[model samples]
Target chain A: MADPIDFWFDFSSPYGYMMAERIDTLAAKHGREVKWRPFLLGAVFKHTGGQPLPSQPMKGPYSKHDLARSARFLGLPFTMPEAFPVSTHQACRVFYWLESRNPRLAHEFAIGVFHAYFVDGRDISQMDVLEGVAGKLDIAPEAVAGATADDAVKAHLREVCEVAIASGVFGSPFVVIDGEPFWGVDRLPQIERWLEQGGF
Target chain B: MADPIDFWFDFSSPYGYMMAERIDTLAAKHGREVKWRPFLLGAVFKHTGGQPLPSQPMKGPYSKHDLARSARFLGLPFTMPEAFPVSTHQACRVFYWLESRNPRLAHEFAIGVFHAYFVDGRDISQMDVLEGVAGKLDIAPEAVAGATADDAVKAHLREVCEVAIASGVFGSPFVVIDGEPFWGVDRLPQIERWLEQGGF
Candidate 1:
């Protein structure tokens, strides 16, 4: 692996969660390391003209077929999350917390949240729900609380998103390596190609 | 050209106007023929969950960038219509009417509408404005009157949108060469590629 690639993630996005779940294997296939950088989706939407799921008109039909299509394409189970657009404050806090001690655990917790909302139909915005998800990922509740509440961690989240926006970042699950913003999860193959050419 | 490629259009779409103004040049370059199909965007949106230009937040920023970008790209004066999302019923009606008798006149009128909306910012949906534009294109005002009143023309408008939806067409300026749908004006080059290959 050469230089590490940074993946900007938001807790509420199914696409972000999907990228988090599979990026590692995809990165490994190309011989690279992924550094997960969590951010607030609400903040991202403030500056960018995007919708919060229910607002996108094409969402229903596209999402209806997305599951079966995504499953078959990626070889993964994709159930539409019920507790989507969930509050990610606590979940994101846990992510910041776990990243300090166990980045792998943080990654697992994110995957758990994705499955919870889209597949299991659970509201993941609540504190208890987020904590429960952390528990499933074998993370201590205190670690999550500390990580989520830490001013520095919260600042890091804001800083990353601001950086993303300043650089003309439009949507989530985008990775910028060597100044190229790879927009969608579908562009992972293109990302691999860049790293291979030592473009990073 | 082995077959007539469908060029789907709506009045509110600047990109469609841009394509309409210059598609013939592309046709000549690739040795292809085009079949224009005009439809009401309101009907398409009602069926597909699409938003009007003013209603879409992303469109604001995108439109600002697009006007300049398209002008440079297409070598045409790109301008926004004043009374946008203007009723295209009149425009579609005129297209449907002139389609059989004088399609060349219809093409001229389409160019007139594009210049009126994008450059002059005129309201296309208004009958008076349409008649004026028709006059500018040297099309008799009676054609507009006949177009608006004819039941056959109204049915033709409905069929255009119905055919659009059935073909998985999601937006305006959609081009279908053979059975493959090339969406968006940006896909013109790719559309030409298929045309060169005899549309496979």
Candidate 2:
């Protein structure tokens, strides 16, 4: 089997959520597995000097419209959360915590967090919301709380983000396959082609 | 026939060049025409506070790689010009000047300019290079020179750019189908689907 594809995304990113829903199945088709790495886009933006998509001028409204249209195109249900572009530190920490224990459970937890925020319109930034999401997956509330406040988990996420920057990850839904970096959910097709062709 | 699709792009954009090559054929497949609008992205960036892709930090290097990869994906030849993101004022003026006389000829000239800059690696910003491209199409060199110098033609180009901004065009290779804006060469699949399904 080939090495797992690194899927980097911020929990608050709509495109990231969309990619998360599809990447596993897409990779499975080509005999590949995806390693989901949740990182803070805000931290990455600090280095790139990029703002959230919804905060720009004319592009802001267009991005909102595009997100809804893209959702319909992908046949995925999406409701724009009233409070968008929220912090994902808690969610990332919990994900990294679960990842250390069981990678599969961590992947499922990540998906649940994405669904909570993107579909249910729940704020995963809050501990209660993340606890609710983790509870659904048989994870204890105390464990979720401990992960969020754990200094080690926080440091682990920070290291992941710094490594992401070093590897040239500037956007959410970034995929790196064999050192070839593909950014954005839009690059899904290219990633699929790359997997099928083994580097095109 | 439905209204023609509005294809907006900058002469210096790599994605725009790729879209220019494919949009016509894709639109024509759906029995639609495209209005190729060449406007200055630099002007739009001033309003949106966006910078050229190659000028940013990590994204700068990634964009160059993506351009080459995208070119291969699309089966098109691309050569990064030594002088990139050049001024297209002269090219735009000449385009509008010819457009007033002949839209078809102007479309051909637009293709010529894109080919000169992206494929041939010629500095289309230079008058001599523009003349060389124009000469091949049997367009008069003197006419090209006159259009470049004409104040009215320059003003027309400016008006075109202003209108592009008013239409919420903030990026190169932006397409609008019945007020549905799709940005980037990555949106080509969505554009094709929109044309096929008549607004999906």
Which tens-of-lDDT digit does each residue in A1-200 have in candidate 2? 78999999999999999999889999999999899988989999999898999889998999999999888888999989988989999899999999999999998899999999999999878899999999999999999989988999999999999998998999998999999999988888899899899989
What does DockQ come to for candidate 2? 0.89
Give candidate 2's TM-score: 0.99
Superposed by TM-score, candidate 2 places the C-alpha of residue B83 at a distance from the truth, in angstroms, of 0.5
The second chain of candidate 2 has a TM-score of: 0.98
- Model 1, position B175, has a per-residue lDDT of 75
lDDT of each: 0.70, 0.93
How does candidate 2 score on lDDT? 0.93
Q: What DockQ do you compute for every candidate structure? A: 0.11, 0.89
Q: Hey, what RMSD does candidate 2 come out at? A: 0.9
Worst 10 residues of 1 chain B by lDDT: B58-67
* Cα distance off (Å), candidate 1, residue A12: 11
Where is model 1 more than 4 Å wrong at Cα?
Answer: A1-151, A158-200, B196-200
